[model samples]
Target chain A: MKVPNILKKTVPVAVGLVVLGYLTLYFVINQTPQWIPENLTRLARQADLLENPEAKRCFECHKEIYAAWKKSRHAIAWVSETYIEDSENRSKEKCLPCHIPRQVKNGEKPQPRLDHRDDGIYCVPCHVIDGKMHGPYDLFSPPHPTQKNLQYRESKFCGSCHEKTFEEWKIAGVEDTCQSCHMARTESRLVQKPVLSWLHSKKQVGDHSFPHGEITQEDLAVTGEISGKEFIVTLLNQKIPHRVPTADNGDPRLYLYVRFLDDSGQEVDRFKEILAPQQDTALLYGKEARFQYPLTAPVRKVEISLQYKPAWSKDKSEWRQLSYPVTGDSG
Target chain B: MRTSLINSLLFTLMLFLIPLQLQAKDMVVKAPPESLGKYYPPESKEPKWIQQMHKMSGNLGGVFVNLREKDWDNLDKNADQFVESYKEASEMVPEWEEYFDLKAAKEFAAAAKTHDGEKIGKAVGAVGKTCGKCHADNSISVWTRFHWPSFHKIKITDPIEEKELDFGKYMGLLSGTFKGVTVNFKEGQYDRSQKALRAFKSRFMELKSTCSKCHTTDDVKLFYVGENVAQAFDGLQKELTAEKPNPGNFWKNVGILGKQGCKNCHLTHRSYAMIQERWEEK
Candidate 1:
């Protein structure tokens, strides 16, 4: 096989040009200002506009985080039926700030966004501070500028909206910060999409579901017994950090029902005890609640149950049972 | 023509190099330290007292199963063996002896002698409660190290309510049940202890269900240290319902439940914390 001089000269020249061209492109992408959508740029430029469309812009690059955030309670903070109902059909001015805050500033109460109200607690509200996106790490995000802020990594960041919970946490004196329990991280590569994954590194992604409401049956121990003509029911709050039925505005309630059954298994007597945030019966974390009822007649069996009502409702909604029935014999 | 081809090749090459130049450095950030302490008990050969404890647990389970099966002879045999093992362990760890109720053992033996299923079952439950109480008081710190990390890993959305699972409250339930079992047992309120134990078992099962969502069924079963512990409870239930319960064997089964059931799982999964620690170091 004979090799031509012209062909050999051209091959090296082509390879060298290709390498040099690629290097130029890379430098330009890394160093040049990231391209921003016109609408977001307009929003970011405005001083009075609290709601910035920049969050949607963020979604273009951070697709996975956006997807997770979309499902979180924060995403629906403005649209939830319960919140709307509790906030007097979204007319409550004070409540709107926390639910649809523009941005969280250190030691300052957040203000509601001027627009994009439906995007409650959107990405820009927490991530954007004075035109820069802040996060726990200062990673290279070519699409947007990022700054590392230690506050974003602390519980105080959550305290902006969850003031009462933060106070409760402080008084409880546990070492765990809000992120430790709520935003637990697992070892994995951060991005889910293939193209972007190549650019990103392995790190912990905060679970955006923000687990709440699923109660461990054992955490709240309820026991009942009839002793000396008195039916005694004891409720213990062993592990919850805040009150058993805790919330900023929701009126959660705990109900104890005691029913006495005769020889035929028919209910002969019924006694009810109610614990609510408004009724001064709310059980604090690591506290106990005891209710006693005077027995009027001899009964074959006494059945006791504990139920939880998330909030007060005008409709006759059945409350969820906290645990299985505890039955005791009545002599 | 040659000049044009060379220009085209240069253009193609430049485009390929863009990604290389723009590629971000793979960040290697340290994960935040875990808030709670990772308990690592001093490593040493199995102590004599621990071996006795295992025997006692196995005897407790044996008594329960034999009683349920109406094997009176084995039940009596296990119950006697458990009593002796309990005494031996108690003598070795006298400080922990106050937590054990020898009177309950004697009563269980008396019930076994009568071959009365109901009486024997109650006695066996009492003995089991005593064991649960002691474990809850003394062994909880060690046992929790294996299971607590799992709680952090669990995340699920409720289908009905469409809300996130309250992991904090769930943890509260676990710790509460763990605490309740001990407190009730220490008070000699076997009935309350039994209920608490049942609650603990139920919660543990519920928590274990989440494991399968992310893990294979076999992996979950293998990693779950509670399988044998649950089996021990089943043994207790059988003896509790048997027509003629044997106290001796029931007690022995309980000993196995404590020693092999709980201890084995802890030993197998002890590396979980160490692995987590290594990650932290990285």
Candidate 2:
């Protein structure tokens, strides 16, 4: 079984090619930074380091993890609409301590300094191993090295700030938790039943990312009309407390003044109720605040106005109003 | 031809397998019903917020009986049990049910259970606190002119008594860091709203009594309902002011008196009979 001349020549060429590839790869590998840099992993592992200069350095290495954290609710917790509504000092220490845990926890200079006020939820505190905490919280350092426990992965971690919702749940006897409601098993269409009909459409195929983002007024068409005079408007309450164009307490409630202005801008008579009840016992899910308004006259334009104020404002005209037109025709 | 067919089959297989793998990973991380407690502190020691909230709820219980119950001491003795029960409901119960907090309501019940005057006062205080917190988070504020007209035009009209709008009596009670923008009214015309909101910033701090605590801040922006009605009322009032210019008539039309809009009744009105008759169901 002697090898053919061509085959022998090809084998040597292949070996030579393989050797050259190995040498190239070796040089490339040596030049690259270490995959698990000691200090980087160390900072990520320790909650204290995560709060210190080490955390910023760790981000230099673990860019992906840091990005995920920056986008999270924890990083920007203080700056959140709900938190800002709670107090005047949107950048105050009381709020920042829980939101930007690293600032207070690490005792970084500038005393109560937050590296990223915009980053809602800090990451390393939540994800680091050995970052053990007693309850939903533990103010003092744990006796052992800190670790990210599976417990933090649970809804109770979120419940620390969401006390009202947690209590309502426990009292009501609902078994479902936040994680069950928010996280997904598949990147399927988020609709409870898939709209298979969309597949037949001329549009490109669905990517099925369970589309979650702020849906502007433009995206929401007057999908269904009660009558030609009445239209259903799906407006997003991007803020957590579920009010459009939110403002401070007890001053002015949000009023969706839906006026069917004729060709001339005159208010038409119509049946109007408060869009949704303040004690919104009606457990409607999703971000959209669905409102139905009936117009008195033939409406050329349906205007949706969201005015925010408390019941006892010092002045009426001072109330803030944010009015936007729904894209599609209501009539 | 065979290779092409196999390649086609493999493409379909890859798409199917990839989605399946992604789906499996997603299931592991998917969110649970928000009602389920994600993580509980092993021992159920309520936070400062919860404790303060309980004390307030007890105050509400007392409010129903004695309109002028002071401090949270009455709450601990009378309403503590009711607040404790509701606290359990709010902290422990997991769904929205009929009278969900009713069964666990201890403040009001504690008063009934004990039949003590001071105990009843405490129970009411706790309940009031809960209402205050809920209203604080959820309601909004609106200002309406309730002052008597400087000039009277009509004769033989049903006249209402003059009430004080003096900021002095309510100096400590109503002074709060109001997170609202102040609008300049120039000879009855609305001017531009400024960038920085001029809060009655120190209002909440001055509010020592339950009435001041609950009614001082406006949650008008937070109300889930009555936007249309409120606007209509506002527009109608403006129209009436231009046309009628009579304070008594406008007050009659709005069905309210005093500076505060709805809080005028809800906070100031004590008798249950009057509250039922005057106020519409929220």
Candidate 3:
């Protein structure tokens, strides 16, 4: 065969470009899309709630989702002991709206729902509007009266109440929406209330738990070392694209506890630093919160731990812990 | 003649005393007179009592309309026809025959022949009062006793144990299994709770077959064992058996299961079924 030099060279180059382009497309598409603060449509007060729909009514069909949401903090937000004490047994009306929020539209801060305060950011408030149930998809829920509102996919919809966290997320320029992490999507029938449920096709349904942090070892990078008289630990928000201990008006605190032990696992001395958004000590996106502690005489080892109080909780719970033994040596 | 009069007095006194004793003592729900059975199911293909009542009603209406038109011949015929039906219906129930105003009915018929509107009106009023009095005394009793379908014959094949069970026994078994879950869960017996929940889930799902048999209406069937109740059953079972089960959550889920899975159906059918069962037992 006659060798066509130009054709051979061009064909190889074209094939190379095609392969490279394919790889680029694959990687780029999988990367999380940056959070764009949507100019969400006003969940305007089109009408009052439909006869104060009970949470259990929503549960009749959304049983699985209800089960998940039932254990979530949102379910007991209004009834939580901390919330009650903090609000002075509901004497402070200003602290109420977000706890028992009304229709969560991107408008002014929502007013508290008058009755059914125990429901606390339930299905009807988030999904129902103006006598019609609104959601992310248009489904054939006959006689049920539903409208498709795509804004549920937007970050601004959640921003209506999570005002500060949404702002932090937007500033982080992460390629993910609040729904991406918190309201993780799974393919399932939207309404599982049967007979009617049989007719539905699988769709992306968000976790109704509005889940808390999915903190993993990789999400918060913890590294520790010890010097002659100082033990310095650096905790970085490596993977989570939002600030740690983030909330609107929440006081969830991340306490870094540094303890010195006399080689017997008995704490001899302890020091604490509160990392919270209000205190500007929260670990931010691609940022680190460092805690450097002094090792006194008779201290043979150091124990480091992070305990956290949830958004509406007053009780401290163990977040995570790690230990380092610098017995007569720096580790 | 003296003996006959004494017997009549004794029978009248007995009727009043019998009712009073029944009220003061056991206080059982009053069943309609046994003669009323001739109007209901198993004795008749349809409600013969209701049919006969409707027929008499129609005839009365015809008589009134004929009277209004001043059609003497038709009014006279209408009155005779009404009297005939009234007499026949009164005789249909042996005990009810005595309560019929047979003389008043005949008087109305006679008044229609006279073509005196005032006399006919008086006779009609007299007959109408008899009908109203009987209805006022007995209508609700008739409806309560015979109108609703009795749970007497509904035999459910309980799916869990795979055995034949009468409606009441089946209901007891189902509820007992559910109650086991509650009792055991409260006592921190998770294994027993899970077992009872498993049995309950099967029985509950199988109930749909029986429900669909009678509840042809989709909504009614849905109310008892539809997708919501089915899902609630399944979700409850899953939660009770989950690896990191939240005991409080399982309790909450059980409450939901009771509402949708048990209480809603009981609200619609239980009290009525209970009354029917009691009636049958007696």
Candidate 2 matches the true fold with a TM-score of 0.32
Can you write out model 1's per-residue Cα lDDT over A66-179, one digit (the tens) per residue? 777887788888888767754534644557678889788764679877667688888888878776668776554534456778786677788888775677777767777777
Given candidate 1, what's the lDDT at residue B73?
A: 93
Candidate 3 lDDT over B1-282, as tens digits, reads 544443443344334323433333433445688877866654543578888888877766666556556577787777788889999888887866766899988987887678655565556666776676566556645766777555665565565554668777888898899898888878878768877876777566656545543443446656666676666666766766677667776767777777886888778776667766677777
Specify the highest-DockQ model's number: 2
- Residue A329 displacement (Å), model 2: 18
Across all candidates, the chain A TM-score values are 0.76, 0.40, 0.77
- In angstroms, what RMSD does candidate 1 have relative to the true structure? 30.4
What order do candidates take by lDDT, descending?
3, 1, 2
lDDT of 1 by residue, B186-243 (tens): 5656556656665655454444333333332344444453456567667755553455
Any idea what lDDT model 1 has?
Answer: 0.59
Question: How many Å off is the CA of A117 in candidate 1?
Answer: 0.1
Docking level for model 1: incorrect
Residue B135 in model 1: lDDT? 55
lDDT of 3 by residue, A1-331 (tens): 9879999889989999988976564443224212211222123222333556779977777787888799888898788876664443443445667888877786457887777878877887788777778888754444355677988888888888777788888888878998888889899876677644654557777888878865788888888887556788899998776678886555566777778888667877666666666444578988877776655457767788888877565467887898877666432
- Fnat of every candidate, listed in order: 0.00, 0.00, 0.00
Instruction: Report residue B55 deviation for candidate 2 (angstroms).
Output: 24
DockQ per candidate: 0.01, 0.02, 0.01
